[model samples]
Target: MSYRNTGTLFTVLVFLFATAGARAWAGSQSKLVAFTVDSVLAADTNKGIDVRIASMGARLRKVFSYTTYRLISRQRRRTQCGRMTGFDLPGGRILHVEPRTVVGDTIGMELVLFQGPRPVMTTELRLKRHAVLMIGGPHYEQGMLIIAITVDTPGSHDVLVHEPRIHQHQRLHAVSTPGQAP
Candidate 1:
């Protein structure tokens, strides 16, 4: 074959290889959108000591999708704790004085957050089997929690951790400090 013909063939091969590589990395964009609504809050409450409270409700839906490109064998895979927050409200707190209680194998996961007004928060945690999802409380202004999990399979897996129901309630009250009047 002529030099020009050889060069053309090489270019075509290179293009195909590059395109394949990109597609492999992205998995499937359409699939990803399927598993996108991981979690949602259907009920929330924000109440102060004044006996006044505001309430809200929310819904969490599946928000992500994945497909196996090569399966990577059927080996057991583990994932570290993964956590993401959708909101970080200031001056808000989580009202849970009781220590966390773990009942059974699948009955010990609780997360709650409260905001004053015009603000809300959401979080998402994607994990595999035998993994733990740790949820801390709102500390200072930007306190956060952690979620740890492990994947038991190597094939493509999708997880949707959603509440599908949340009600938010909050009360308005003036901050109490030294030299402050009610």
Candidate 2:
């Protein structure tokens, strides 16, 4: 090959290598996840609301019609895409959350709510960046339980709480497997 052609080939190879590295970095970037588990109690009267979950009280009333909702626990974790992170929930249940990918401003995640060794609920979902996925009802206390999971971009403010943004999520990309993506 001519020297000129060799130089061109080297330049093209360099560009391709850089592009592949960038894509890998983007896929493996750390995701900041915020999860809140609330213990909700219902009553016959429209009397009480917990100040901690006051933001969610109205929504709870609208969806659940329960008299009260309290924030039992609020925790946040940072994990890479496809890595599993476990959260300790009320009633000794374990929640395993795995963040998969980001498409535009939306995030893809998988959740498994386990009681002891058996898996109770497992779902794969995607939601907008600012939205929170609330999984409610599983018998926690007198009433039930609500688990809210949020994954947002770094440097963003705390996500707001709304009436359980549990819309049908479309899978943007095929997952490798649980705990198996880079």
Candidate 3:
């Protein structure tokens, strides 16, 4: 082959190899995610917690007196691995969450709840896309406190709740999942 033709062939081979390497590297990188934090309260009732949450409508009414109890608050946050965010909730409670690891469609997170800088509760959660994690009361009267965390992803409907009444509450809603539309 002529020297010029040989050189052209070498250049084309190098370009193809470089492009393949770049695509491999890009495929290995973790995907970024965004999540939202919501805090809500309901009047403490004699009905079982399952019954109460099942009946909870799309719009929650403020039955408990905020003035008498702790203030209710909501905040939106966006974060990636190694980053942390905080949300303030009713009854002087603050929630701190950090994403520890993200693999494929699963996210590993650390969640901590604090009452005035004192850590009241801490837990780890692995959430899938479009999933929600709800944490309920530490109970005031018949009133219950709910803290919900949801990820922004399409068709990812997984709901996990960690609280004292979760088992009993799970039994009530057989047809609908916690995060799914009721």
Report the Cα lDDT for residue 144, model 3.
58
Query: Per-residue lDDT for 1-182 in model 3, tens only?
Result: 99999999999999999999887655433344566676655443333233334323322222222212222445667765666778877777888888776666778889999987899899988886545676765553335576767654323454433222222222234353332112
TM-score for candidate 3, residues paired by index: 0.53
What local lDDT does model 2 show for residue 174? 41
Candidate 2 whole-model C-alpha lDDT, 0 to 1: 0.67
In model 3, which runs have C-alpha deviations exceeding 4 angstroms? 1-31, 44-72, 140-142, 153-169, 172-182
Clashes of 3: 4
- Give Cα distance to truth, residue 66, candidate 3, Å: 17
Error of 2 at 154 (Å): 2.3
Sort by TM-score, top down from the best:
2, 3, 1
Question: Per-residue lDDT for 1-182 in model 2, tens only?
Answer: 99999999999999999999998777556555444444444443455777876766665555554655666787777676777888888888888888787666677888899988789999998878766567765665555577766667565554443545544444456445322111
Q: Rate the local accuracy (lDDT) of all candidates.
A: 0.27, 0.67, 0.59
The top-ranked prediction according to lDDT is: 2
Ordered from best to worst lDDT, the candidate numbers read 2, 3, 1
For residues 3-71, could you state the per-residue lDDT of candidate 1 as single tens digits?
999999999999999999888544432111111111111111222111110110121111111110111
**How many residue pairs clash per model?**
36, 0, 4
